[model samples]
Target: MLRQYELLERVRAYDPDADEALINRAYVFSMKAHGSQKRASGDPYYSHPIEVAGILTDLRLDDETIATAILHDTIEDTVATPEEVERLFGPNVARLVDGVTKLSKIEAQSENQRAAENLRKFLLAMSGDIRVLLVKLADRLHNMRTLHFIANAEKRRRIARETMDIYAPLAERIGMYEFMTEMQTLAFRELEPDAYQSISKRLEQLHKGGGDLIDRIGRGIRAHLEASGIEAQVQGREKHPYSIWRKMAERHVSFEQLSDVMAFRAIVGTEEDCYRTLGLIHGRWPMVPGRFKDFISTPKRNGYKSLHTSVIHDEQMRIEIQIRTGDMHAQAEHGLAAHWAYKEGKDEAARTQHPWISDLVEILDHAGSAEELLEHTRMAMYQDRIFAFTPKGELIQLPKGASPVDFAYAVHTDLGDQTVGAKVNGRVMPLRTPLDNGDQVEILVSKAQHPQPTWLNFVVTGKAKAKIRRFVKSKEREETIALGRKLFDEIVQRLPVPLGWEAIAEALRRLHLHDDDALMEAIALKRIDDVQVMEALLPGSAGKGQVKPPPQRQAISIKGLTPGVAFTLAECCHPIPGDRIVGLRREGTGIEVHAIGCDRLADGIDADWVDLAWGNESDGGTARLCIVIKNEPGSLAVITSILGNHGANIVSLDQKARDGSFHTFTLGLEVHDVPHLMRILAALRATEVVSTAERI
Candidate 1:
């Protein structure tokens, strides 16, 4: 743990105006509050907060952030209250400390839910003040560093996975490369111990074989840059293990197949020299096609800038190089923390200036669930990025594999909701087309166009996904509620007494529903059947017993006036009177009625099963038949004439494919009942032209 005076000295070295009294008070107060508590590492719990504060001091954060770090765990782990911290150190420190105290109230939830809630709390705090994120990140980093102290294997893996999924990505989002890299390394070490050990062993073997290859490459690059009068600093290293593992997984390649594992950086004095060094380096080597990117002109959303290239070096080694100015290098290394290091009010300035921070705020507004928010926020914060342009030349950055729908959403939520189509490179393209780097896109939208659920399959951006989902949920509920209302009115007519608002209120209470809409939706969805709904509305209205289905041989009433709206008859079985039926409630559309013995009903992927029965109200219904006849003249006539003799009218006829020796006909015949259709089929089967005939 950092001593009080030593911590203050570290803060004052960076910020001479830092409040030494505040730091001292926080340090002493946190130590006293923690008392004799111990960590899983068997160290004093007070030591953890002090170490977290020390980490922040290395970032050169303000004194208030350091104080917040000290008290962050005090409110959660100790008996200290937020009010006490506010009283001692003031509101800024208190607020940040409270924000970083703990993630979420994870009570009795599934593991997935708990993880989502933790991320939800973290993102909410980060949006309020970026320093909350900074402190919490430091706290998590310290916890992750000591995670091995935990005895439970599952517990350790859970913490490691959460850090890998959430914290590391978050750190990267704010331009904190050093923190992100270290967190990822620690998490990777815990999550995949075997891969970690194997990769480490391989790296060690390579290092031993190369004999200071990184230093030699760095020296060679520095020599070349200085010789060209570029005034640059060069550094080289092997790639990160996690990065290498990810590449291996993505490309399905082995370590030996990887050519650009060695990366070098050239830090130049000016922006011009950054590019000059790039040009000079390319001039001396054979450039790798499609391996160059100029982030200097189009910086990342987090404000990172650099020129990247890969080349075949004089040593005949393929290597990756990044060239940037010193200031760019600092920002790339420290990210948003660099803003606080050099200026006053930079904390708030950075929070306002960065699009990503505002996006986190925007995400909070539209998320419907914690799991959803975590998923979309991860998509927004963590991914390899691709850059594209709007029709007017405005640049848009999106995750790799993002579609035009993502581009529209990145521009504006309303634009995404109204997106109909897109034109890529001046040619009309499908909306699901994945955008390419540097592709100029034109989003074709309209006021009449609404978000479609199918877009969710293709859109990869979180903003696009959340907005589309919100719209879809709203639309489905609106339509379902309207359908429920119509069904409610129809059910009310069958009741003994007329219902009023009082009856609805009574039903809502009995069903534990919030309002009439909930009651009606439940009714439409058959969550509460007619008898249950009537009983809730008015006691004993449905009598002592619920309505039961008639015997198997008897046909009950099933009125389907609107085939596509209220329900649809399954064309495969062509159900009629005296045929048992089943109803499947499909998504988006309504239920489909299938014969009980239909082959299509055997598939397991159907929607919710609804009880269905054949109605006696119909005089007759259509039964389709598939007939294979000899390929001779008058075969079609013979089949039609036979059905006509049985008093079965041809509703429709379609010629199917013709095989070598036989032709097929799909015929829809109107019959009085199932028995009548059977009689008609018997006559058709006896014909000379009909080779095989059966009801479809």
Candidate 2:
């Protein structure tokens, strides 16, 4: 029932050459493709694509994106095919339609998993060509705007959660701040209607009183700049409700404590004018210390650059002001899209501006399966970034709080493998030091060092983790293959007659294995009995019915332990190798073991405590211990030195502080016996200012 002129208007907005003939062809094709179809709202299905196309046109997308938007749903819900689309339109238009079509089909086992996979697919498509995601986002925006039409509550929640996790983040990543705000606001409204209403009402009241004040402040600032012969446009924009909600949660403060909820933007003609405008603004108002940022000189990782400062007006009202050139404004609004010029055919230059896009596209080239490509896409796209730097001033981009090990891997796998230590801001730090913005990190590497299995715990980047996993898996495969080959050769030597491949294969099948390699590896690991392999290869072998005897059980009992209690292994002493241990009955249940004089036990023990002993047959495992001490330089180095000297491999380490000067650190280590653990504890306690050391 929609008029044809509306569709024509959208096409003509981006394409001046658009005419009635083209619009008519699209209309007839879409009408036939979506014959008698109705949406969940019971509206004619053709109306949805028209609405989606309208949204894209409003965003100033190119002609192909708009056309693709018009036909996006045809292939999924109708009889239309990609081949037919290509025949009707050109390859570019068809590709865009195909991308949008692919995004509509992922099915996961649960709502959360479905949302996650849907996001994964969206990122994959976006990485290939950003316009695909743009069109999809526009579609989602329209759907969210009309979400009330859907009837089911569970379905509504599932869709809302997906929008929150995927679409909203996608909008932010692309620098569509306006779209991001709306999507988040709508999703919040659906997911937590009560919270949304409460926050919305509060924000509405705040805006009513403060709106005119911001306008007055903007006028005053504009008058001053104009009097000084500066040419600029000043406008006041309030923070979105979702952003205010996020700020409240992050700062744990009430809405009244939130300042700078409104900001003034100054748009100028040149980059030099931006800085000059900043100087003029500061002269008019007092600038707040540590509240100024010179992003123009050093842009954000996403390529956002502006001069920002918080200043107090004559009435002592605080406001944030941002100064940037007109070009920067366009970049801020359109993000990577603003850089692409179709007329110039500068694809390479455009890709250079958005390196992450290129990196994501490159993932497709190396990806072997659809699932891997999808995974790589999600990891590359849906991440919040932190900008850190090498000591030499080279920038290294990583996910927020990425450790030095992640940094080393970002530089090169070889560097990560050889990295022995690191320094942040000229002071040595632990390998797990969470990086902050603008940090100058210097990695110390030794030729003999290699990555430990524990490095996986602190790494934040998916690329770094994937690479580490790949390297470790490769090494493990190589080792297992070599072990398998060695065991096979030894077993063949013991055979009286040469075994045929068929006999070996049959023997492997009887053992539930795939090949000789697996059977031999199982033998190497003692998972398969050695005598059984010979029995399978020979007739009437004695090993056929002979089950191996269980190993002798070490007879041991703890005196202070109660029966029928559940116990957990202590991480501090990681009871591995060989060691003497004593059990302490905890108040609740299971026994806690410690190297007899563990400081943790000593502090808790009074006259009522009794001694407990461990059974003789205990094997090596892991244990945890806590150390409290003064925070100082090289503190971690001293601890690791002691543990390393005692031949104990440190498995995990975490540290926190009650105050800046004092820290409590938890360290997990493997030890041979109770005596060795006590010796390490004594060495750690000998360090100055060490208050306590005990098994936890």
Candidate 3:
């Protein structure tokens, strides 16, 4: 732990204007506050906060940030209160301390829920001042470093998982690569001990066998660069074990197959030299195909910039190289902290501004559930991103494979809802077309356009999907409320006086509903029946105003099956809208629709049969098709696209059989009628992989 005077001197070293008295007060106050407390590591608890403060000093953060770090735990672990902190240190430091405090008192639904809720609160707090997140991250880092002393294995793993899942990604999102990498390394060690130990052992053996190989590689690179008239500082080190293990898992390759285990960095004096150094390095070695990325030309969303490349040296050894200027190297190492180092005492609004932070704020407002907030924020933070542009040249960073709909949503919710089509790079493209780096996207909008259920099929971003779902849900609720209101009015048509919104409001208490809208929506969804609604409006009037039911079933209402029409059973395999039907009339029974292949019509001498077809009243009717498609990449997408083109929506698809060459899919489609179904089948049959497509 840093001593009081030593910590102040370090702070003053970077931030010469840092408030020494404020730092001294916080340091002494925290020590006294945690007077008798001991951490699981059997050290004075104040040491943890002091260490956290020391970590922040390395970033050259403002004095208040460092003070917040020192007093972060005082509110949570000690009897010290935010009010007291405010009285002593002012509201800014108190608020920062309060923001870092954990939500241990709130009763949560589950452990996952607890985590999600905590993240939601933390995000909300951090949005006001990013310093909160910085202090919290420092605290978590110190805790992770001392995690081994916890003794409880389960508790340790839980902390490690949370660190890996949430904190590491957040650090990375903020461009804190050093923090992200170290946290990931520590968590990976705890989560996969066996793999970690095995990799560590292998690394140790390699180091023992190769005497100073890293230093040798560094010297060789430095000499090569100097010979080419490029003065540079070159350094080499082995990749982290977790990074190596991840590559092995993703590529399904053994450790022996991995060649580029060591990474080297070349820090040049200027940006021009960074590229010049890259050209010279490539000239000396055989370049590895498809192993280069020019981040300098297109910086990451987090503002990370470098020229990354891989080369095969000495005809066998593969090595990864990074070339950047000294300033770029510093920014890459410290990330957002780099900005603070140059701009001291910048206000929260200026300091906290970031695309990812803006996205998190949007998510905090729009996410449907605690789990969803957690999920979307995780996706927003962790995914490898690609940059796409609007026609106006505004950059939109999205996860790789994000579709145009994701682009539209990232632009604005209104634009996404009104999007009817899109043009990528001046060419009309499919909505599911994956955007690449620098592709200019123009979303075509129409007043008639609204988010379709199918948009969810292709959108990859959490923000896009969440907004789409919210729109669909809100629209459904509005429609259901309207329907319920219509149903309620019909029920009250014969009443003494018409049941109005005012009357419903009065009866809400008796109906066990919150408000008029709640009652109406419930009635619309049939959760609360019409009779119950009528009775609640006028007490003891359940049957008085209710119309008596007809002797027979008034009208066969199967929601979407029959829009507003009445239908009788078609016994010939129950010919519904999708099946080919023939009407048959028995002696006294009404016209009955029968399927063409009904067994009852074949043997039995049935009544006279008449040709029948589904009426125009039908909106969507079920149709069955037997499809044989080759088992290959995108086969299913092709079939679905064909159907979608012909205005068919797949209700369900079941696999009947599969061979190495071909697979049979039994698909149920919600189509207009038999003719519409035939059109879909025709399109499917015309597809290349589709060997056979016929109505079943």
Lowest-sum lDDT 10-residue window in model 3: 557-566
Output candidate 3 Cα RMSD.
24.2
For all candidates, the clash counts are: 0, 20, 0
Q: Model 3: per-residue lDDT, tens digit, 1-696?
A: 689988998988877777899999999999999999999999999999999999988888888989999998898788998899999999989877876774323222356544434444445446446677788788888888998999999988988987887678768766788998999999999999999999999888888887898888889889999998999999888899999999999999989899889999999988899889999999989899999999899987667889999998863689999999987887788776765552554444454433344332333333345344333323334235665666544546677789999999999989998998899877999898998755778999998988876788889988899988887667666655654565465556635555666677767887788976888677645565655776788766666544544232221222332221122444325345656665553443334556778776765365544444554455555667789999999999998888878877787899999888999988877777666767777787787989999776
Once superposed on the true structure, which residue ranges of model 3 sit more than 4 Å away at CA?
Answer: 102-110, 114-118, 342-696
Which RMSD values do the candidates have, in order?
24.1, 25.2, 24.2
- Misplaced by over 4 Å in model 2 are 1-3, 18-24, 40-42, 107-109, 340-696
Candidate 1 vs candidate 2: which has greater TM-score?
1
- Runs in model 1 deviating more than 4 A are 102-110, 342-696
Q: For every model shown, what is its TM-score relative to the native structure?
A: 0.55, 0.54, 0.56
Instruction: Give the top-scoring candidate (TM-score).
Output: 3
Candidate 1 per-residue lDDT, tens place, 1-696, comes to 678888888987878888788888888898899999999989888999999999999889888888888888888777888888889889878877766764533322468554434554455445446777788788889989899999999988988988887778767877889899989988999999999888888888989999998899889888887888878788899988988888888999998888778999999889999888988899888899999999989987676899999999877789999999988998898887765563554344433333443233333333344344333433334335665666544446677799999999998888888899999877999998998755777899999998887889999988888998887767666665665676566566667677776888888899999988887667656777777887887788788543233232222235533343345678778888778887775544556778888899877274655556655565567888899999998888887778777888887889898898899889888888888888887887888888888987
